[model samples]
Target: MARVRVLMAKPGLDGHDRGVKVVARALRDAGMEVVYTGLHQTPEEIVEAAIQEDVDIVGLSILSGAHMTLIPRVNELLKENGASDIVVIGGGTIPEEDVLALKEGGWAKEIFTPGTPLENIVEWINSHVKSKDN
Candidate 1:
């Protein structure tokens, strides 16, 4: 078995990154290989990084209420680039009503709103992301 690789990124103009950093560190502590793409990445840049890094998961943190816009773009790009197998998860300030739609729309595999435990994120990734090396 191989370690799960996760690419954690903050896309668009969301400059508040403390939460993402916390999650990144948590994921790292949990024995996963984590790549943190610092603030203000475009969707294309994020998708490119995910592909180039050969990550098993792309974890996006956004607080700008742009999930409906950005998540789909990232998802679309991943599909268009033949990388749709990359699991997409997100967090931060997302509305409860949008969660189901985001999941059903195939943009976000999971969306963690405010107050979600770090343990939950780690466990979800552990269960969902298969090691590509397998």
Candidate 2:
């Protein structure tokens, strides 16, 4: 089995990166190759990196309350670029309604709120990505 390729990005002016770094390290430790795009990335940059890297998943860590704007934009860009196979998920200070909106917009498969276990994330990616081949 091949290692999962994950692109972890922090979009917009949200300067908090500690959580994203932790998740990246955890993903790496779980045998996934993680591409961490540091702070202040635009939706275009994130989508371009995801395509160029050929990542299996794109993880957006947003704490700036712009989830409504950024996540959908990224989703649209990915779809337009023919990279819709890449699964997008997010975590951070997002309201439940916005999370639902994201899902409805096909922007995210899941949104992890605070206190979600890292192991759960790894398991989710493994199951979801593996099942895609079937």
Best candidate (score: TM-score): 1
Off by over 4 Å in 2: 131-134
lDDT for each residue of candidate 2 in 1-134, tens digit (9 for 90 to 100)? 67789999999997989889999999999988899999999999999999998898999999999989999999999999999999999999899999898988778999988888999988888888742323
C-alpha local distance difference test of each model: 0.94, 0.90
TM-score for each of the candidates? 0.98, 0.94
In candidate 2, how many clashes are counted?
A: 0
lDDT for predicted candidate 1 compared with the true structure: 0.94
Residue-wise C-alpha lDDT for candidate 1, range 100-124, written one tens digit per residue: 8899888899999888899999999
Best by lDDT: 1
Clashes of 1: 0
